[model samples]
Target: MLRLLINIFFLSLVQGSVAGSEPYFSLADYDAASDREYIGAVGILSRPDLGLVITITVQSGGALLLGDPPVDKIPSTAVKRAVCGQVISFPNLPERNLVCR
Candidate 1:
């Protein structure tokens, strides 16, 4: 019972650390030649769901500054990474045929 309590305490601390960290979003494109994902755009948002409530557009092929309006918010449901040519679906959004450079 003591060991179990210790394990739970450790897990809580780890979760707290993760929750305290800032969240950011990035866009990646698939490189066909190398068959790898390359980060194209990165942005830090005030909240994950801020994009859902506001118009936040990220133009590809460029890096966003920390305070840029475009990077101020991101979709809460955005994935960390996705494979090219794969179908992606999100809540309240229709499925899309994802194709990246």
Candidate 2:
């Protein structure tokens, strides 16, 4: 019974990994698209100890760059962070199913 369970667990892990590795983006549509047009993206904001992630595309500027690309220091040209804490003072980010454009 123990060996059976172990095999099942490993099988499930392999299945999950394969699914995640599949391309989620559609190349045909992306190629046809005239522009990326700020569809929406996920970004991580870092504080002293923790980080917050959100999906948003409706900022003053259309293009929203996800986490500062894990920089050693925040770049001067970097856009403001969304906020990474229990109490977020930033504006409300649109939830899933809501289109950013």
Candidate 3:
């Protein structure tokens, strides 16, 4: 009985941890000039000891034009702020390519 209870408790903790680490899909607009689209996975991990950690993994990205390459300015702060599933745009670039959702 004690072993079963301990196993159940561990199972619950594992389930909660897995649930907390699930990644969510978000739109990634690497290029606003083209009709292409992209997708990214955003995941947030939190622990009482570790505070919070945000992770943005690009699942798929759009293609760049022949003469146009990606800009060096990536709005990481804006992306972190907009992680709650909101559209974010980067207006500093001339072509305005870095947009995240």
Candidate 4:
């Protein structure tokens, strides 16, 4: 039992170190907007070397306008990146421009 416990502790230490060594990327901000007629989402992506990236997407509910509006849109869902070293904002969209730092 003692030997097993020591091995388990060492394994846990190694795993913790490995996990901490890698850089982590996370979504800084996420929001959704709707006027009861249209829906949109915005997200901010952040990383160590990569600057902030703002992403915006809109989905129309067709003519029927069925289903509830989405509330969980995240930055990772964005497939396009704004221009480097600049902030771009849309006049009509609710999300502000993504500013690269």
RMSD of each candidate relative to the true structure: 14.6, 16.4, 15.4, 17.0
Model 3 regions more than 4 Å off: 1-23, 28-50, 61-83, 86-101
How high a TM-score does candidate 2 get? 0.17
Candidate 4 lDDT tens digits, 25-89: 22123232323222333333233244332233333321111012212212121222322222334
Q: Candidate 2's residue-wise lDDT over 23-86, tens digit each?
A: 2221122322442332334432223342223222322223232222322112121122223112
Clashes of 3: 0
Q: What is the C-alpha lDDT of each candidate?
A: 0.29, 0.27, 0.29, 0.28
Residue-wise lDDT of candidate 3 within 53-78, one digit each (tens)?
22323334432111011111223343
User: On TM-score, who's better, 3 or 4?
Assistant: 3
> Runs in model 1 with CA error above 4 Å?
1-82
Give the TM-score of each candidate.
Answer: 0.22, 0.17, 0.21, 0.19
Clashes of each: 0, 0, 0, 0
Order by TM-score, highest first: 1, 3, 4, 2
lDDT of 3: 0.29
- What lDDT is reached at residue 6 by model 4? 36
Model 4: residues with Cα > 4 Å off, grouped in runs: 1-50, 60-89, 93-101
Candidate 4 residue 9 Cα shift, in angstroms, is: 35
